[model samples]
Target: MRLKSALSKVFASFVVKGIEKWKFDAVAAQERTLKKLVNEASHTVFGVDHRFVEIKNYEDFKARVPVRDYEDLKPYIERVVAGEADILWKDKPEYLAKTSGTTSGVKYIPISKQSMPEHIKAARNALLTYIHETGNASFVDGKLIFLQGSPVLAKKNGINVGRLSGIVAHLVPAYLQKNRMPSYQTNCIEDWEQKVDAIVEETINEDMRLISGIPPWVQMYFDKLTEKSGGKQIKDIFKNFQLFVYGGVNFEPYRAKIEASIGKKIAAIETYPASEGFIAYQDSQTEKGLLLLADAGMFYEFIPSEEYYNEKPTRLSLAEVELDKNYALILNTNAGLWGYSIGDTIKFISLNPYKIVVTGRIKHFISAFGEHVIGEEVEHALLSVANEEGIEITEFTVAPQVNPTFGELPYHEWFVEFVKAPVDLSAFALKVDKALQLKNIYYFDLIEGNILRSLKITILQKDAFVNYMKSEGKLGGQNKVPRLSNDRKLAEGLERYIA
Candidate 1:
């Protein structure tokens, strides 16, 4: 075995053993984390304002700090950005993870010195867990690429500001530096398409074994590779490629088309990472869910998805979460975010090790006529039919059509970009509609009671999602198209690209 591969095995064994200690006693670990975070931040501006000193337990913490989104926390964040110290956390944050926002224009999430290590460790441990579980450390000896944002960072009030992925790029371990591709100069390109082109030029002939990114961006990279190589499969281009590490979106929707482009099925690791924290990762190949990071520097809370918008939603800790129920995930992190809502909804699949699957975004859902359809349900419904019928979906999104151009009942409108279109499009759409109705009962009732017509599918031209994302200036680097939207903003924008 190569030196790096042997070292990876030893390191992975150690990491996995450490993780196992916290896996079973997750509740205890979370209790300790909450206590530590509250105690540490008691003197900070936000902590003092929220009376964190009196927060002796989860109930007290809940009473002291209410769930807040970026907008609600913007006051403190602005203070921090203006060179304020001891505001959110004990001291000024080391970095600000800048992200585009819906109403706020731009969001700057603090990454404190204390909390930043957890982010790096979680990502490393994810790989270590994979190595430990599968005994596949050979990928360590080969080239690995993470399709990400430019590593070039801007400064805000003497603090580094960049995308989370770009921030992570600077933190990659020195040991992996030689194995990592493409070069720093190539990674510094700001334009995503141009960056991918540069990446293809740099790494096309290298022995690539592991590729990591959000699925859509990785798909674009694969497309570029094939086009450049005159339609050769990715597996043909990189014969030793074995592992795909991805996060930000569910891999299932892109699995068929992605694997087809690669020309083979390969091992994949699903991770649940966010600017707020590294939440979870697939701990086992045989497991159905990602293992929640209880020992991480964040205290987690969950409110039932149905009660999310209520005056006072029921907030439950890790101990109180039940299996298979949708909940809007809330966070209180050492980075000094108190009762922060990252907007993602998740479902616990295992209570034992606290495993979860991201269900949808709290704001990204369709409830046009009381049929509250989530991202997971729609993706599941559509992908089920597609997989069963041997059709390949490149991308899809759904929105409710409240008003029709003609004298027809309103219905759910699905805009789909397919790699392989079904032979009978109408029948295929009906089958998918049936599958969705099964997943969400309210949707079934709406269809049965004639409140809404059956869902309609609008075939989209190739690269429709790409074009739409580009128009929105969200073409790459952790930008994901919502599977279902409560409004027609995304749907109407995509209409221009309809086939």
Candidate 2:
């Protein structure tokens, strides 16, 4: 083996051993993490304001700090952006991750020097865990590509401000710099389509081994490569490709299409990373959940997702979580985020080691007529039916159509772009509708009571989602269409692309 490859194996082994230290005692790890975070930030502006110094335990911490979203936390973040030090953390943030928000417009999330490494470490551990499990470290010898935003950052009061992926671009370890692609100049291109073209141009003939990105963007790259190569599949162009690492959206809905594009199956790792913190990662290839990062520099809290909008919801510590219950994740981190809701929903699948699966987004749900429908339900409904029927879809989204044509009852509208159309579209729609009913009791009750009609599927033209995202200026880099929406905005916008 080459020197770098040998070193990678050694490092992967070391990391896995470190993981074992706290993997079994996750509850204690989280307690230690919370205590450390609170004690370290006790003298900071937010800490002082929230009485962090007086917090002795989780109950005390919760009593002092209320869970807040980006809008609620904007004032403190604004102060940080204006050159205020120790407002949210112990000192000035090392960088600000800029992201678009629905209600708040643009949002800035701080990343402290102490907390940034946790993000890098969790990602590294995910890969190293794979190596330790399968003894496959040969990919380190080949080229790797991560589809992400530009690394070029703008300044916000002396703080480097950019997308989280872009900021992460500057932190690729020295040992892997030579193996990473597309060139910094190519990645810096703001136009996503042009950047993909440049990436394809640069990577087409290389010994590419690992591809990482949000699945949709990677699919776009594969499409370009296939088109440019006169219909040759991705595997033909890059035979050494062995792993697909993705996050930001559930992969099951896109699995068939992605595998078809690649012309074969490959191992994949899913990570749960957010602007607030790196939360969880797939620790075992055979396991269904991501291991929650209990020992990371962040403390966690959970609110039952159903009660999230209640005046006062039940908040649970790691020790209090139950299996298979969906909760809105909250964070208190070394980065100075205290009781911050990141807007994502997750369900604990394992308690002993604290493993979780991303269920959906707190805001991305369709409760238009009292029948709440979440992302997990919609995805399970669609993918279960599609997989059963062997139908392949390129992309899809769901929205409530409260006002239908003439006297028709309100119904869920599915906008789907299919690679393989079903033999009977109406039958396919009914199957998905029934599948969803089985998953959500409220939806089932609504349908049975005639409060809502069966879901409807609207066939979309090729690249309809791509066009919609481009029109909205969210073409790539961690941007994904919400799987469920409560209103008709997305449905109305998608009307133009009806096939």
Candidate 3:
């Protein structure tokens, strides 16, 4: 392992001063292209673009190409599988970003040749954020920070045999400084142990000011940092490491405790990215609230929560979204996932366009005995239960678990890491169960307990959830503790109690 002596640390601190600063800067062409993407997103369907040049205007485009869900594109994707790439757009796909789904094996999502630039742009934006927050830029010249995401691989047939991380890793800008760590591609993910080992060694002795990756992986990095340093805490170890960046899903459950363990309120950035594109980012000032990259190579639309389930959702174009409204995000990217619903639920936070907060996944819900619960409902119930119990829940995950006696019913197991464990589990369960009942009056009576007593709470010590992830081999990279379990197979995989 590379070791950073105290002098090396001081010298590295001097090096940090020369790194270049990144501002949220772009050229006029970038802005024009972004606007075009948004406009195209607002107007098209089934591989056609500039569909409403005949419509002659923006509002007419909105009236024609309503926001759509993934299922709506099933036909187009099927056509792609049949060797027709033009069903959605004109580009022949450079590659497909494979995303797993419960109903399907793996969706070979066609991301266009043009999508690579957005990845670099999002990265620069994230880097810019670090410079602004830390006041450190080429602003100094130490080892460049590396985002430890997944790696890429090439097959005998010349097709990439790895994830999106692998593909993007191959596309790293040659212009960046050499002080940076290995690209996700070169890290060689297929050899997991070796990949992790290399990252651990590099992180221990290097000057890494900004680290970007999935939250679980970053957490694992800190844990490994401690282990590599012969049990020194991360706070004592990564003294020069200023900010830890993350994206994908909610960091709410782990935020307070992770910060506590890091021994400082580490500046945290939550981003909204997908296989389709880096759709948005959380501002340095906003924290959890994300700002849509409205000017990126994508057109965006938001359909009201009520209309999300309808065959035709009422669409709000990028120029039309409002504050505090629950909307399902729809996208039209340069990659050609036109009118695509990423299936995330975000609430608009500001009206000038692009300011939003990702509230939760569209399907991240718990029914508590077939009540058809949603994320908002779960958050509400959790808060109600916490308030009633005079406690605060720091970590929790809700899923459907089966009990033979109760048959197949959705259960919200409150695995809480609290400030203090509450005395009354029954009352806490009752409080949550009651709020759920407000959503579905039939649930209480449907269950024998007359209050859906299946709901339960288990208090945990801080770091318990992180420890669980470590044991599960899901501690790092592009994995999350699956938030909703529609069926037992995947649900069983995330159920830590059984193991």
RMSD of each: 0.8, 0.8, 6.8
TM-score each candidate: 0.99, 0.99, 0.76
- lDDT winner among the candidates? 1
Full-model lDDT for every candidate: 0.93, 0.92, 0.61
What is the per-residue lDDT of model 1 for residues 296-387, given as tens digits with 9 covering 90 to 100?
Answer: 99999999999999999999999988989999999989888989999999999898988999988999899989999999999999999998
lDDT rank order: 1, 2, 3
Judge candidate 2 against the unseen true structure and give its global Cα lDDT, from 0 to 1: 0.92
Clash totals in order: 0, 0, 18
Tens-digit lDDT track of model 2 for 300-416? 999999899998899999989999999999988889988899999999888878899999999999999888789999999999999988999899999988888989998999999
- Candidate 1 regions exceeding 4 Å error are none
Model 3, residue 13: C-alpha shift (Å) = 23
Of 2 and 3, which scores higher on TM-score?
2
**lDDT value, residue 35 of candidate 2:** 89
